[model samples]
Target chain A: MDIKAYIILSLALFTIGIVGVLVRRNAIIIFMCVELMLNAVNLLLVAFSKMHAMSGVAKASPYFASDAQVFVFFIMVVAAAEVSVGLAIIVMMYRNVHTVDVNFLNRLKN
Target chain B: MNLTTLVFILLSVMAIGSAIMMISSKSPVHSVLWLIVVFFAISGHYILLNAQFLAIVNIIVYAGAIMVLFLFVVMLMNLNAETEPVKNYRLQLVGVITGGALLLVLVSAVMKIDVEQLVEMKVGDQGLIKVLGMNLFKNYVLPFEISSVLFLSAMIGAVVIGKKDETANQ
Candidate 1:
């Protein structure tokens, strides 16, 4: 497949994620939108890795294309850890405020 | 035209559709469920790109674990559609317009870049577990160990934050 097609698809998905983050007021939905953006980036990275693998330089190194996939792996790891901590914070916030609306989280302004 | 392109189009539609549904849904639980559908569609894309390791990991980690955590939290909070907070329609309109503007700028910039490359579809072994494992343990061993420490810290942080604050309660 043409790399441009993948790029466009990934860009569209990322745009949808950006829209989700901006339009939603729920903190959890916002977090999910962030995850969607991360996945879009991951998909593009893998596509680019394949593009690099098809290049002549990759003939010299068998592992040339593996770097991007490894980066995606670590991204997943960090995202998992981040979700744990973030959800914990969200839960604590709900306990205190009883709502997940981002608008109500303005205590810092005072 | 071919099967690969056809599958790619299908998966892209699935992902984008579910993501929109996730944001538009009123209930947090529904949003979480829709997000899982998006993850599965992305996993399908990973598989189409021949990144089998990432395909499996994305399903297991994102769809299975993290989404379940989100669902659990939503249920624990007893958040339903009726309890959902409403925002002014003008603010939502502004947000949608802003997001659309950002997309237009990014898409235009990306179109200007010269990309004559082809993505290797189901034809590469670089995405296999063996290659990834060798690279991870050989060249990237330090980052692997550091990631474990990061996980530990995150675990501790979650526990510390989630624990009932007796002092604050008193």
Candidate 2:
């Protein structure tokens, strides 16, 4: 597949994620949008890795392509950890505030 | 178009459309479902790109564990379409415009790249588990081990934060 096509697709996904984060009032939804953006970047990284391995320089290094995949694996690990903590925070917020709205989190403003 | 390109287009459409639905859906449960669709599409892309290990991991981790966690939290809070908080339409419009502008700039920049490389698709062995496992256990072992510590900290932090305060009720 053309690398440009992959880039464009990833860009579209990332843009949707950004819009979701900006537009949604729900904190959980916003967090999910962050996950969307992370996945988009992960897709791009994988695409770039394949592209690099297809080129001439990768001949010297056997591990060049696998590096990106390994990085994506670690990213998933971190994302899992992040989601656990973030959802716990959100759950606590909902428990205290009784709503998932991000606007309600403005108590510090006062 | 060939089969690879066709599959690529299909997965891209599925991903983008599901992502749009995920954000636009009124119900949090529905949004989580749509996000699962997005994750599936992304995993399909991974498989097409011959990153088999990442593809499976994406499905198991994102679609299985993380999304289930999201659904559990959403359901536990009793969040639904009727209870969704309303934001200003003007703010939403502005956000859409801003995101669109960013997308435009990025797409334009990406188009300017002169290299027209083809991604190595189903033919590559670099995405195989054996290759990635060796690489992970070799030079990347330190980061991998440190991530375990991070997970430990995160688990403890979540437990600490979610615990009920005994004194506060008194």
- Say which candidate scores most in DockQ: 2
Residue B110 displacement in candidate 1 (angstroms):
1.7
Among all windows of 10 consecutive residues in model 1 chain A, the one with the lowest summed lDDT is: A54-63
Top model by TM-score, which number?
Answer: 2
**Which residue pairs collide, candidate 1?**
none
lDDT of 2 by residue, A1-110 (tens): 78999899999999999999999999999999999999999999999999988885757666777888888999899999999999999999988989999999898998
Q: When superposed on Cα atoms, how far off is each prediction in RMSD?
A: 1.1, 0.9
Candidate 2 scores an fnat of 0.90
Q: Report DockQ per prediction, comma-separated.
A: 0.83, 0.89
Q: Write the per-residue lDDT of candidate 1 for residues B5-109, one digit (tens) a residue.
A: 899889989988898898888888999999999999988988888899999999999999999999999899998999888678888899889888887888888
Best by lDDT: 2
**Candidate 2 lDDT over residue span B5-110, tens digit each:** 8998899999999999999999999999999999999999999988999999999999999999999999998889999997899999999999999999999999
lDDT of 1 by residue, A1-66 (tens): 888888888888888888888888888888988988999999999999998887757477768888
Give the total clashing residue pairs for model 2: 0
